[model samples]
Target: MKDNPLVIKLGGVLLDSRDSMKIFFDFLSTYFHNYSRNLIIVHGGGKIIDDMMKKIGMNINKINGIRVTNSSNIDIVVGALAGIANKRILSYLKRNKINFIGVSLSDGDSVLVERSKKLDFKNHTGIPKSGNPKLLFDLLSKKILPVVSSIGITKYGELMNVNADLAASALAKTLGADLILLSDVSSVLDKRGNRIDSINREKFNALINDGTIKNGMIVKVQAALDASEVLGKSVQIASWKENNEKLKLLFNGELSVGTFVYK
Candidate 1:
């Protein structure tokens, strides 16, 4: 990877919309080709997987936030993520004429994964333990953006479903890069619907306690804080829908556009 690469994670409502993906990819093309920036895109396909499972008459189960994957549904999970979702992003990148590669967490051994011990789903669910940056480095060196799916593999060659946010965190740590978690929401909003510019652990707790931050955002902010601590830098939680102007601000070393979380 470059000396200071950026890793951006995408999922939730953002991943399900073609219009949003197109706009986001356009921004990426401009950043990479026009501005000469380096970045890796990590994405999750939870909604796609859920819809596919339901169509196939499979029951969805989860322990904590990790999905349960096994012999019966690994194929569906992989197909939804590595196959459909990966291609969906790639197609947009192709339209933008950006040199990009679609890959899964297991591809090129980019991330070292094992059966998740935190959850008891046997060999199906994966927890990323470490990263091997060589493959990503080579791709980035060639100016090829890696669009990674959250699907991983175990040593035994079992396809494991990995949490996309945690996978992005592991990759950022591995490559010594900054991280940005992008979703549908623009930023962590106060009760008045204004964006909170920064959040530290104390403020995070206060926000949670005051009911300003609740539901899914609580989890997203927690993940950002964890990544910030691990990387020894701030992690950004921004939206991909704002014409990616927040990303431009972040690349310009300005934290004013998004909510920057510190450890």
Candidate 2:
């Protein structure tokens, strides 16, 4: 898919640091101006949501890294992710003079989702079932970058709290795009805490079985694996904390600084 966009997913911690965001926008500004490539950004704000809920006297309930959301707190989830976090990123893009549109997973019918029965979240949690990337494609055709939040809706118009990693995968699949999941970790680690330069399904399964990958990393890696398989390409797990030069190199295909998960 030569015409496909490049999807970059941002981890929430990067949102907390001005220097990190500055470097990110600096690299993006250059890439947008020089490369003339289409780009899409999917973001998570779990830490921001946690802080807001804590301030409002709401309990931070979660099961296996998925927030255990309910009708009572779904509003807060929406406000935190789509409202606050989304605007915060948009502010950076605007400052950089990047032509962009801010949206959520639900906007433009980009991602269709429903209640996730896999978990007992007591109410409104969702998993992406399918997608229609036409709206995103239209934006890309016009060379407008989209900054998407991990918020979705069901057929019946119910709000959903989706995992950002999974949201990015779903979008990349629908758009037939290459994905880069930028988190705080430089790469996937092994049992000895060394970086895994590359991984395949078999090795990934072995790592999971032996308990080397746990917590949030489990979900993030699984998302990358799923995207790799679907797209028939390798997916990268890199850190957003890296400096502008490393990010530029990564984007330019000049260097490999992260774990590449192959199908």
Candidate 3:
């Protein structure tokens, strides 16, 4: 790997299954154990938190598939998403004897919330505060992995919702990482159920216009767009569920499979 950082956006599905989750950690232990590259693992806890809420008999209210979390749920979400998940990953690294350190948004006294005063956007637009990139740069320079949670802190001293995809993309821009979004599906599928192997702005717009790309992918596409604009490189979306061989291929740039949204 290059000296540049690698920001990995891990979705909720990766932590949903017991077997697959174990495999994910095992794979990381094997492949990235001593890999001399900077990494930041940003996690999503949608399914995990939702399931916990259901277990506790809280009726879920979702708007556009994004959970509507109140202040009470914020603690629950952060506990599960950041505490449990982050600890599990850190434990795996320790068990494997990998030199890794885990930290969160507060580790450096930084906030990554949306609608922040630190953001320099106009009305009708909003962005998460660009938490001092110097903070993350220093962590990476130390060869430590800063594991991030989806929940972020706003400038108003309140916790706010943040898309893990968008956070990873923005982190990559800030850290100049070669970002990779690992998800359950192999890639964005066409209306005919075929995988989109490669994509650029024009082709992606065509797919959206033709209605082959819609729904959850809208946020993902926008994340990729923002990362590419800021970092001058594309974000790759690959199936985290694929066996080691296929994963190796994509990580090694073989591109035998997976979808790439690039400039």
Candidate 4:
């Protein structure tokens, strides 16, 4: 259990649902109190950032479903993700009496990142180079949940915006943790609007090639694949909207509710 913690990546939309979030926290509280499992949460705030950017008349852009972040937008990204978004999650945890510490990829150099080299988008966007999970291990050993935001810092101390799914993947890989990516959708769907219960790398590639999976879901599936390959295990892509019993069963390895990405 110490070697493998449960890492859950939450989508930004979940934060907007007060009732859903309350129920989710209630489940978490009960689960933590009854079990000795170590848990880590990584969250996104894309919707919140987009709303903030709209209020400030800042244009938000994306390339291939990944946010095109520049130096001009980095501060707003941090404020939205690390500041407001992180605190909002903390507030919920506090309300639920769950012990947690809010953190970012910058904390303790947990996730060392470099400018994304694959895509020539804008500046200040990063891909995880490596991660040091000592800080996470220390926190987990003390029974503290680390709620991380997807904001990374460069070696020169420049802040960079990261895709939350990839950020979660980096942390899961570093910590040798089992990952569960919680999205608004219950599962990945086929072109005919059917849920895909499981996918392997080859099938995933076929889906992308045939245009079955596109946009942000592409990024998510890619991250899930990467984590699954690294961990030599399947990663679950489930819904944040699931009921407490379903979520509990899913986490306990008793029920399968969503698409499982395998190596």
Comparing 3 and 4 by lDDT, which wins?
4
lDDT-wise, the better of 1 and 4 is 4
lDDT measured at residue 244 in model 1 versus the true structure, 0 to 100? 62
Ranked by TM-score from best down, the candidates are 4, 2, 1, 3
lDDT of 4 by residue, 131-217 (tens): 788999999988888999999988877788888887887888888878899978899999999889999989999999999999878
- What are the per-model C-alpha RMSD values against the true structure? 2.3, 2.1, 4.0, 2.0
Q: Estimate every model's Cα lDDT from 0 to 1.
A: 0.83, 0.85, 0.68, 0.86
Q: Give a tens-digit lDDT track for model 1, residues 92-211.
A: 888989898998887778888898775555548787855788999999999999999988888888788887887898888988887888888889999999999999999999999999
What is the total number of backbone clashes in candidate 1? Answer: 1
Candidate 3 residue-wise lDDT, 162-258, digit = tens:
6677667666766666788887867888899998887888887898899988877766676666666656777788778888777655555555476
Q: Say which candidate scores most in TM-score.
A: 4
Clashes of each: 1, 0, 0, 0
Candidate 4 weakest lDDT stretch, 10 residues:
121-130
The regions of model 2 sitting more than 4 angstroms off are: 1-3, 120-122, 209-211
Model 4: C-alpha RMSD to truth? Answer: 2.0
Off by over 4 Å in 3: 109-111, 116-129, 200-202, 252-256
Which has the greatest lDDT?
Answer: 4
